[model samples]
Target: MTGYLVRRVGQMGLTLFLIITLTFFLVEAQPGDYASFYVLNPDLPPDVKEKIRAAFGLDKPLWQQYLIHLKNTFTGNFGVSFGHFPRPVMDVLAERIPRTLVLFLTATAASFYLGFFLGKAIAWRRGGLFEYVATISGATLFTAFTPAFALMMIWIFAFRLDWFPLWGNSCIGGLALDILKHMVLPVATLTLISFAGTMLLTRNSMLETIREDYVMAARAKGLPERQVRDRHAARNAMLPVVTSLVYSLIFAIDGSVIIEGVFSWPGTGMTLLSAVRSEDLPLVMGAMLFIGCCRCWLT
Candidate 1:
């Protein structure tokens, strides 16, 4: 395991390096320089703009800028934010990463576990109420619906009707309850968007596994139904789910941006999104490379 981890980490590092190189060139390839933002602004004087560009080494040769950027990056300096005053990109990101993480980690854990157990139950029962309802409720909707609309439906039906809280964060006051409160809408949203795909995948895969020769052999040997299902069928059925879930986690990390944007939650995803929009090269590249390395890890 130790050797495996070491190899994976090294591979992740190489993947990240390549991401940095690729993004650096791509960002540079976009129209105009970072200084152009100021130069085109009606309010800024040309002389001050030149000085700002010079000070930030924006006026330097591209190769020199790349070398300097890499050196600073190696030393943990992600560079100054063009938008924020007296703030480093890393610091800005660090402050928000936790809150965004809270939203995603909460939503994902809820989505995956609930989907897994419910899916397994539905698979076993096949034609039951849970199966029918889960198939219907989960099948037609997705994250495509407006978040607020869905949340409002849940709030009016579930919370206003006494099913759950309408708005709250579980991160403070009382750790568990606060989390439950804040988690209500976002978790529900994620779960709703997530349930159908997972359920369908698990149900289909599990049905296939139960019919396999090994499961039949176990049954012939008089293993209990539960034992046959869990030991033989469950493990095999879940292998793909486990791998897919890991890939989903990587997507969660990057995809959190949109959900974060919707919820006004802070996380690396939104920060990266902002960086891309602002054309803050260092921050954009840092985020892209970080996300890419994470994706490589999942793969």
Candidate 2:
């Protein structure tokens, strides 16, 4: 187990290195740097543009910039953000990370519980109408276009029914209840789309597990049906489901980019989007690196 863990960690380190390198070059390859808007203005003289580049170290050669970025990344010094000027990249991300965690973690828990419960029920009663209905519905939802579904949910719940706020993270006063209220639509959107996959996986796993010899032995021993199902079948079926749960939680960090954007949530996802649009290389690179690290180590 020690050797296995060491190997996994080493692989994750290599993957993270590749992710950092690729992100740096891709971001640098963009047509203009953070000062492009100021540099491109017709009124700005050549000297001013040169000054702007010098201020941000854009005057450095590409290789030098890459090396500097790599060194800073390893040292956990993500420099000041071009978008949120005068603020360090880490400081900007610090404020946003908690919001993203709250939203995605809550959604993941909700989806897993709902999916697992429904999956077990449907699998246990294999031939029932409820099983068919749930399977069909789950498949449909699993295949739905995420952004469009989110928009439709907003239209129905927020716009048409006025049941929830249209967007944004919180209301005035920043009450916990107000924050939860704002989270409802986006959280529900993510949960609804996600639960289907979990449900199907659980259902399939349960089906296979129930056919195993150990399950039949449990039943043959005159165990109560519920005991036989829960203690025997469901417990064993959980192996694959647990793996799926880990992946869901890890990737949800990256997935938040879209969900947060649609709901106007004040999370890292929205922060990254704004940074990219504004050509904030430090902030963007920091966010990408943070996400890559999460995906790597958390697995």
Candidate 3:
């Protein structure tokens, strides 16, 4: 186990290195650097722009800058944010990460619970009307376009019904009830879209597990149907579902960029979008690296 863990860690490190390198070059390949804003300013002279570039190491050669970025990343020195000037990238991310975590983690838990319960029910009664309806609905939802679905949800619930706020996250010291109310739409959207995949996976796994010899033996022993299903079939079938849950939780640290954007939620995904639009390299790189590290370490 130790050797296996060591190998996995090594692989994760290599993958992260590649991600960092590729991200750096791709951002560099964009039309302009972080200094482009200064370059376009009418009041700032060329010399002042040069100084600004030097201050951010934008004046350095591409390879040299890349090396410096790599070193800084390893040392937890993400430098200052271009978008949020005078603030470190880590500080900006620190402010946003908790919001993303709370949103996604809550959604994940709710979705998985709903999916597992429904999947177990449907699979246990495979030939029933419930199975047919659930199978069709789950497949449809699993294949749905996320952004369009999220928008439709907002339209119905927030805009037309006026049951919830239109968009935006809660205030820092807001009422708990207000925070939950604001969270309802985004969480529901995420849950509805994501639960179907889990449902389908669980259903398939349960189907296979129920036909196994152990499951048949449990039934043959005259165990109650519910007991046999729950303790024997569903329990064994949960392995893959649980594994997928781990990956889901890890990848969700990046947050849903489109959903957060659509809802104007001030999470990591929203912050990353703003950073990209403003060409805030340090912030962008910091966010990506943080996400990559989560993916690597957890998976």
The best candidate in terms of TM-score? 3
Please give, for residues 1-73, the per-residue lDDT of candidate 1 as tens digits: 9999899889878886777777778988998666665577778887888997897788899999888877876
| Model 1 RMSD in angstroms | 4.5
Listed in order, each prediction's TM-score against the native is: 0.74, 0.91, 0.92
Look at candidate 3 and tell me the lDDT of residue 250. Answer: 67
Ranking by TM-score: 3, 2, 1
Model 3, C-alpha of 294: deviation from truth (Å): 2.2
lDDT of 2: 0.87
Cα RMSDs, all models: 4.5, 2.2, 2.0
lDDT of 3 by residue, 87-169 (tens): 98888889888888889999999989999999999999999999888878877887788889989998999999999998675
Model 1: per-residue Cα lDDT at residue 4: 98
Error of 2 at 92 (Å): 1.1
TM-score, prediction 2: 0.91
Off by over 4 Å in 2: 37-45, 84-86, 171-173, 217-223
Ranking by lDDT: 2, 3, 1
Candidate 3 at 166: error in angstroms?
A: 0.7
